[model samples]
Target: MAHLLFRLRHVTEEEAAEVRALLDEQGFDVYETQAGFFRLGVDAIWLADTRQREAAEAALDTYQQARLARERDAFEQARARGEAPTLWKRFLAHPVQVALTLVAVVVIALLTLLPFLGLATP
Candidate 1:
């Protein structure tokens, strides 16, 4: 059948499972593919048939929005309970993510500075 149409990134295995359950519940044929090679996959890729594209998209969008709302509510509840999350907890929890973020920041700064340094003026 038609698979490998669309995908998502940065979602955990549990999240992917939840999304798969949701899609199945909505009667959409869906599956996941490995998006990267390493200790951890980059993310899960959700696939659907070409014929199911429109409905699949709508369901995924709704599910993601609902998940976002749930996360926002959880954050608000944590703040109300005086258990606010720490910045370091958010950023440095994954060493790979932290290192990649630093690299990205450095690359962006260098790119931004190059034009100001007259390296691109002609």
Candidate 2:
């Protein structure tokens, strides 16, 4: 029986390719499945041999740790250079969009709280 090894949903193409290459390099017998038109199926990698699960999992864990470290280092470098994205930066980049979003949020919150506030008054 095949065991699910990794989920591909929300994973970037570059990350997926790297994961595929890593699995292949590790000599794991694996297969990939795609979510169909209705998205009912899972998009994932599966290991054909259950006996290799532990080894495959360990390899994946190591790879993930390395990737996480690399991403953190990149973010740290960006922050040091004052290039990392911040809320203020985002608002500056798209002021109108940000203002609209804030308005929508306030409207939603007021609508949600209005009934409760009326109950408190009585």
Candidate 3:
């Protein structure tokens, strides 16, 4: 039976390619599945040998940890250099979008609380 090694949902292309390269380097018999036309199908990497599942899992875990650390360090460096997009930076870049979102939020909040406020007032 084939064993699912990794789910590809929300995974970046670079990350998926890196994983594929890693598996190929390790000589694991792996294959990938597409999400299909309607996107209702599975999109994942599968291992042909169930016996190698543990080894594959270990390799993937190590890769994920290293990737996490590396990405975090990069993010920190970007933030330090003011290259990271903060909330204020986003707002400044797109003030109209920010204002529209704020207005929508206030409208939703008012709509949600109006009934409760009326009940309390009566």
Candidate 4:
């Protein structure tokens, strides 16, 4: 029986490609499935040989650790250069959009609390 090896949802194309390459290099019998029109199915990689699950999982774990380290280093470099995205930067980039979002949040909060506040006043 095939065992699910990895979920592809929310994974970037580059990351998916790299994972496919890694599994191929490790000689794992793998197949990919796609979520259909209704998105009822899972988008994932499956291992045809359940016996290889442990070894395949180990390889994926190592690859993920390396990828995480690389991403962290890149993010740190960006932050050091003052290029990493921040809320202030976003506000500055689109002041109107930020203001509108803030207004919407305040409105939603007020609406959500209004009933409770009325109950407390009695």
- Best-fitting candidate, scored by TM-score: 2
In the range 1-122, model 2's lDDT, one tens digit per residue, is 99999999999999999999999998999999999999999999999999999999999999999999999999999999999999999999999999999999999999999999999985
Error of 1 at 9 (Å): 3.6
What are the lDDT figures for the candidates, one per model? 0.73, 0.98, 0.96, 0.98
| Candidate 1 error regions (>4 Å) | 1-8, 36-43, 46-48, 88-122
Q: Which stretches of candidate 4 lie over 4 Å from their true place?
A: none
For each candidate, C-alpha RMSD in Å? 6.0, 1.2, 1.7, 1.3
TM-score of candidate 2 to 2 decimals: 0.93
- lDDT (10s digit) by residue, model 1, range 1-122: 55553456755767777877887788876666664567364344445567888787787788889989998999999999967767676675677888888999999998989878895567
lDDT of 3 by residue, 1-122 (tens): 99999999999999999999999999999999999999987899999999999999999999999999999999999999989988899999999999999999999999999989999974
- Listed in order, each prediction's TM-score against the native is 0.58, 0.93, 0.86, 0.91
Poorest stretch of ten by lDDT in candidate 2: 113-122
Evaluated at residue 3, the lDDT of candidate 3 is: 96
Enumerate residue pairs that collide in model 3: none
Which residue segments of model 2 deviate by more than 4 Å? none
Could you tell me the lDDT of residue 111 within candidate 1? 96
- TM-score pick, better of 1 and 3: 3
Q: Which candidate would rank higher by TM-score, 2 or 3?
A: 2
